[model samples]
Target: AQSVTQPDARVTVSEGASLQLRCKYSSSVTPYLFWYVQYPRQGLQLLLKYYSGDPVVQGVNGFEAEFSKSNSSFHLRKASVHWSDSAVYFCAGQNTGGADRLTFGKGTQLIIQP
Candidate 1:
């Protein structure tokens, strides 16, 4: 089974500032990774995903992530964030088999400061 860990349970960043949310994964083999964000009382939205292409992948809303197999990480980053970016971010992955369901992290809550 694969798993993901979010070291920081919460991250506070001022509006219009850059942001980075760390995520580490553990797996027996290379897996498909993804980043998702959830707003209050809303369903999760896909931020980005990594299958087997470039290490860096761009996502919606000016978000991006770099897949680092050597480090066992797929961290999310944004050049700038707004109050609208405040949400819970989850790192999830599934084995290459594709039959197995995705394993998600505990999630990191991003707090936007005024």
Candidate 2:
């Protein structure tokens, strides 16, 4: 089974500060990792993904993630964040050999301080 865990339930950062959201995954085999963001009352939008090739992949809005097989982690990072970046972030994983369904974490709510 593939599962994702986001230890932090909520994160607060200054408007211009850097941000990092933690994610850990477990699977029998290599898994497809993803980070999805959900704005207020809006559907989830993919922030980044990692399947193969590079361990680090760039995403929309200057977001990026690094995958580590040894650690079973795919953590999202941003150099600087804005108020609009405040949202709920979900860490998801899909077993390459299994169904197309994605197993997601509980979610981490991002709050930007003024």
Candidate 3:
């Protein structure tokens, strides 16, 4: 079985500071990795994903992720974070066996400090 783990349950950072959200996964083989964000009252939105080819994929709003098969990690990074960037972020994994299912992490709540 495949699974995702987010070691940090919550993180606080000052505005304009760089941010990195850690994610680790366990699977039989390298699975498709994804990062999603959820606003206050909005549904989860895809930030970025990695299936193959490039290890680093660009995401929306200055977000990008690097997939590492060696470490079985797909961490998300932001050059600079804003107040509006505060939200709950989730990392998910889908097996390449053609299943439409995705295993999600517990999620990390990002808080911005003034």
Candidate 4:
């Protein structure tokens, strides 16, 4: 079984501040990893993903993440976040043999303060 853990349920950050969202997972093998962002009433958009090869992956809207096999972690980072970046972020995974069933965390709601 594959699972993910997002330590924070909500995060508040000042506009233009650097941000890091923590994510940890439990799996016997490396699975397809991804970060999705959901705005007010919109659907989830893929931020980034890691299938194989490079450990570092870049995403849309100035988002990035690094995958660590040893720690079983994939943390999202941004040098600076805008007010519009205030949205719910979810960490998800897909198993190779599961026909791509996405497993999502509880999600982290990010609030931006001016």
lDDT of each: 0.90, 0.91, 0.91, 0.88
- What is the per-residue lDDT of model 3 for residues 14-37, given as tens digits with 9 covering 90 to 100? 999999999999974346889999
How would the candidate models be sorted by lDDT, starting from the highest? 2, 3, 1, 4
Question: Across residues 1-114, which tens digit of lDDT does each residue of candidate 4 receive?
Answer: 437889999999999999999888888334689999999999999999989888999999989999998989999999998999999999987754667677788899999999
Off by over 4 Å in 3: 28-30
User: Residue 81 in candidate 3 has what lDDT?
Assistant: 97
TM-scores of the candidates in the order shown: 0.92, 0.93, 0.93, 0.92
Among all windows of 10 consecutive residues in model 3, the one with the lowest summed lDDT is 94-103
Deviation in Å, model 1, residue 72 alpha carbon: 0.5
Assess candidate 4 and give its lDDT: 0.88
RMSD of 3: 1.6
Q: Kindly report which residue pairs in candidate 2 clash with one another.
A: none
Clashes of each: 0, 0, 0, 0
In model 4, the worst 10-residue window by lDDT is 93-102
Residue 15 error for model 2, in Å?
Answer: 0.9
User: In terms of TM-score, which candidate is strongest?
Assistant: 2
